[model samples]
Target: MPKSIVVPEGTSKPIAPFSPGTLADGVVYVSGTLPFDRNNDVVHVGDAAAQTRHVLETIKTVIETAGGSMEDVTMNHIFLTDWANYAAVNSVYAEYFPGDKPARYCILCGLVKPEALIEIATVAHIGRP
Candidate 1:
């Protein structure tokens, strides 16, 4: 199947060699996203809740740019630098997906950037069966 890159307006140029998202076979595969500013530096520093909000907003943009919405998301891969931030992350996360939460798994581990407390990659199906 053919795939197209999804780069929404104002998206920071990724520090790595990867598109922000890829659309293939009616599915939008969003790359792991961090809470970053236009300079590619981690934002919200030590605040996990703010960081989670930023990451989710980034993913929301990518998905919407690919003709989908948060409601279309099927799964999410969440990563965190510390387990203690789990509640903070989830509290902000619930605001994004208030109903019919997508399937997800959270891992307690290190991120590419030391100040980045959260990273989220998402999958959304936007095509009909």
Candidate 2:
């Protein structure tokens, strides 16, 4: 199958040049997402948990837009500006994938939006490639 980009109607616009998600060969790849609102303004600036939750929510929407689900997620890449917020971020993350957790790698790095506490990207497989 040919590759297709996924962009849910209400999600925040991309901060840079990248699709919100891409689907090819039955696999969906969500780009690192920030906690921004429909107006493209950052949300939950000071609260790590809230920011993480919103980030995952954005990822969920993108994957679903491509016809997949959180259960279909195979892996994720987490990017945060500070390591100190790791535990708080994980607390919210556990709520999203309560049963089958996807393989995840967390990285400490500054984000394009310095107010964002976390960003997440994912790879999901809905079926055979």
Q: Largest lDDT belongs to which candidate?
A: 1
Question: What TM-score goes with each of the models?
Answer: 0.97, 0.93
Model 1 over residues 15-109: C-alpha lDDT tens digits? 99999999999999999999999999989999999999999999999999999999999999999889999999999999999999999999988
Q: Which number leads on TM-score?
A: 1
Would you list the clashing residue pairs of candidate 1? none
Stretches of candidate 2 exceeding 4 Å from the true structure:
none
Measured by TM-score, how close is model 1 to the native structure?
0.97
Evaluated at residue 2, the lDDT of candidate 2 is 88
lDDT string, candidate 2, 1-129, tens digits: 689888898755666889999999999999888888888788987999999888888888888888888999999999989989999998999999999798989988888878888889899998744
Q: lDDT per model, in order? A: 0.94, 0.87
